[model samples]
Target: MSLVKNLLVSISCTTYNHEDYVTDAIESFLMQKTNFDFEILIHDDASTDGTSSIIKEFEEKYPDIIKPIYQTENQHLKGIKASGINVKRAKGKYLAVCEGDDYWTDPYKLQKQVDYMESHPECSLCVHAGYVVSASNKEIQRYSRPNKINKIYTAEEIIEFGGGLFLTNSMLYRTELDRNRPGFFEKAPVGDYPLAINLALQGTVYYMDELMSAYRVGDSGSWTVSSFSTIDNKIKHFDQISIMLNRINQYTNLQYQHVITRTKKRIQFYLLVEQEKFKEALKEEFKFIYSEFGYKDRARMFLQGYFPGILMSLITIKRKLNL
Candidate 1:
């Protein structure tokens, strides 16, 4: 067992075949210059690539600051399971998360969130805006443009926006709240949204408008990646959404109606596509379309139902050509 320090924060970083970007993630945490004590708990889930080697190098260099939970066999899709195990081992008041594939860009990111949470005891979770970077580490999309500061958001607003209020790399939460509820990440293909929702249900959610991290997109390791790019995967995605909605329904004090309605529309759209009922699906989707989206998206969904297969293909071709 490692010597216990008066650490107030513990960053739980889970990695699998992230050799290309793991070094950046570790350096980001190590560069933090705060007055309070903190440590990092790293889990390398038996990655076949050089990810384990990178973690070993960091552990050897900073043995006291970086605690390693290295596994010998591949854990595969059980990455979240392994992460939960490491979280249980963490000894800190707060648990800040930054997966190995993603990294924080600001040195004061930890300090900012810690200070806010310390002053506001009513809040249980803190998150910040982030930018989407390509696999090659180039900036692609800004998460929340035209603004860069912290903003407090309510649970109702988060639920209305489809429950993606915070990214995994930009999250910090109380450890005790998570310890009381085990298997928090067991149900979904990903755990970020579920974790945030659970935390929001307990206390207020604070949002930092600053871009503190760069999320890597277009990576094959991501859950959103299309394996077969077939209708089956689309249908499966909707099914998973349904399961998430059902789970949310079990808990009280949550604005679940909006989530349920949006999920139902998504499922209807994919099912219609699968059953060749595009017209009916479009008519159903119109009822759920939020005003926030642009005209092109609404028109596209509407056209998907009205046009025949041949015309739709031509529209797709034309759009691609224009792009």
Candidate 2:
């Protein structure tokens, strides 16, 4: 691991039962064209699908660059977050993320991000656009930032977007800002959003309008897949989001109160719909209108509840229109 000296970046790649996809992920990291040294902190959360074997092979081949963490048991199943574990172990100036199911497309991704961060020292995070392709690669779409490239964003700009502006896999952050996260992280659901918000609070975040990564959709081994595979799992997901947002509110001290409340109402609507509780979902529809939701979402719930025939007809027309 002699090449680990003066590491400029640390790539955190967390995997579980990703035997079919881990190699592509590792190869992407190895192909990066960066001037400075970097290390890969890949964590295998005790996969039963022989994903660990592939990781071991790569580690053997690149002993100096690929550092693998093999968990004895399924840490995610046991409520242990692999991202948190990897972050604690990563000792680099900047942090890059590439989950096992996702891979980088551009070899110059790291070099470009590093160059930006080096020149613009005030920014805490740099994010780029990515292509979202189906598992079979038949369907592809681009996920991009709302603003133009090289646009700097403050904490308020991030929160006001409601849903985040960029995808999880297309990000690089200052390790120092993320290293000391608040205690609320224990209740956090997902790593990307909360971590982005945390960094934005400390400093500005930049969005580069470049497509450097490809995110795979419908990954059966993803945490959302493993956890939210059933109706009960849907309940847990929404509840966890509530806990996470509450913790975030506590840390931010109600600065984003209205947005949090609106989010809660939105989740409440989805929770009811997932459980097929139409009556309850209708109730939440009214709750959202008074709070923050626009006319489109409001009209959707009304038609689905009051005029099923019209809603069906409208949905059919939209499908035919393909707009």
Candidate 3:
């Protein structure tokens, strides 16, 4: 057994088929200018695309800084999440994440987060704004909240934030938060959001306004891109979220019942719409996904769900008239 000692922070990085971008991630970790000792615990989940080999190359170069778990077979396919597995191996007081595709842009990112976490005992989690870079790296979507710096986010607020207040790559949280993680994390098929919420329940999480990272979107190995592009996958994902929320509600003694239930309903409504079972969606309460859709879109949803034939006829007529 390896002794985990004298580590101030552990960077939990999980990679699978990210050979194209894994080096940037590792270099980011190695470039941090911090006064404290930190370890990078990497897990290459049996990537067939030379991702594991790339990780091995880095491990050989920086054996002291990088500790890796190279799986023979895909662990993610067997319901094991890389962050969860990495957390179990992490020995530092604080844990940070930057997946294979995502990389830290600021060298002071670790130092800044650690300085704040050490100073503030009440904070269990710390997050910062990140730029969303396209796979081509030519375009970026900004995630800045200049007015909300050092804002303390509550458990309820994090849970109801609908998944985009911060990116997983931009988080630095307490390692002990792993101890309070619910069993659903092992099987729920989603991470980050639930993990953040779990930490928020123990202590309030804070946010920094600075952009310290770049989150790679539309990358080949991006889970968000792959998960929601297909109707079947989206429905399956919602079903998993439903089970996860049920377990969370049970664990919290129904404290987040209303919010979780509303979240579940929102997922279900979209699943129904994707499946063209809109009639069923119209029967349930509507929660406006203000972030993704607007009033006219909602009206169109209702029309398509309840009056499919009429809406189809209108669509055909509009196309014929070039309107």
Candidate 4:
């Protein structure tokens, strides 16, 4: 019998054209040293590359622990449809996510997270800081959590710090909560942020200040690196958050507005970048700033516009020179 038969901690790994890195990701999970039980669910989304073969190799070696799902036909669908398929089939009390392009650095990552969750009933979700590495696993930057970890973050806090939170690769949450709410990952651009936000609403979100995973960057396969300036991409991204806010209309109006304000600020920032209109961009960004964000953010946006281009240039140069 499988050790994970009783304890259901499913590691759901999604892969697509990550032939170079999928093997490492699977191997990392297989190497985890846990007292409890866990299973590896590898979902190959019709990778038209050597990704399938890599997964097959792992499956052959560890057939009992590793469960591989290889799609024969390439499902061109993005977002929830493609990724959610794997998550829906997961059979674990808790789900741990690690995409094919990323891998866990600490072998005890699952054990530590599961232990914390099991002890702390109030924590619905647990995440750890991760190192941002290049495609070759060279550390590009380190993402660390704030000194604060036990505090609950509002929707606004999450939206503003979404980039820092990273993706599901560094996350572990209750499985029943996700399975029951199938629409969790149905959002666009990606559903990790919104899903975490919703989960936070249910209970407290705990952050383990350890660097447990290595987030491989420079992957063209990621949505953030993809072309998001197009109208269709913007619309899809906007629609997802809008739908999420609508779903939780009864929760708190202020929270919904916080999400909206954050979204608008991001849209404005992107527009400014794409349009190359720093002045207009500053104005658009200022519109979202209110008493909620305090005078600091407002002052920053104002300075972004008021500062002369040459001054901004000098500051940028100074930073580069200092570095």
Best by TM-score: 3
Full candidate order by lDDT, most accurate first: 3, 2, 1, 4
- Model 4 steric clash total: 0
lDDT of 3 by residue, 118-203 (tens): 99999999988777777666277544342344678778767755255677888998998785467766657778878887888889
Tell me the TM-score of model 1: 0.81
TM-score of each: 0.81, 0.80, 0.82, 0.78
Of candidate 1, the 10-residue stretch with the lowest lDDT total is 299-308
Residue-by-residue lDDT tens digits, candidate 1, 93-154: 88999989889889998889999999999998988877768878556643532124556766
Worst 10 residues of 2 by lDDT: 301-310
Compared with the true structure, the alpha-carbon lDDT of candidate 1 equals: 0.69
Mark the regions of model 4 whose C-alpha exceeds 4 Å error after superposition. Answer: 1-3, 76-80, 144-152, 182-187, 228-255, 284-323
Best by lDDT: 3
For residue 115, model 1's alpha carbon misses the true position, in angstroms, by: 0.4
Clashing pairs in 3: none
Report the number of backbone clashes for model 2: 0
Model 2's lDDT to the true fold?
0.73
Q: How well does candidate 3 score on lDDT at residue 233? A: 77
Q: How far is 7's C-alpha from truth in model 1 (Å)?
A: 1.0
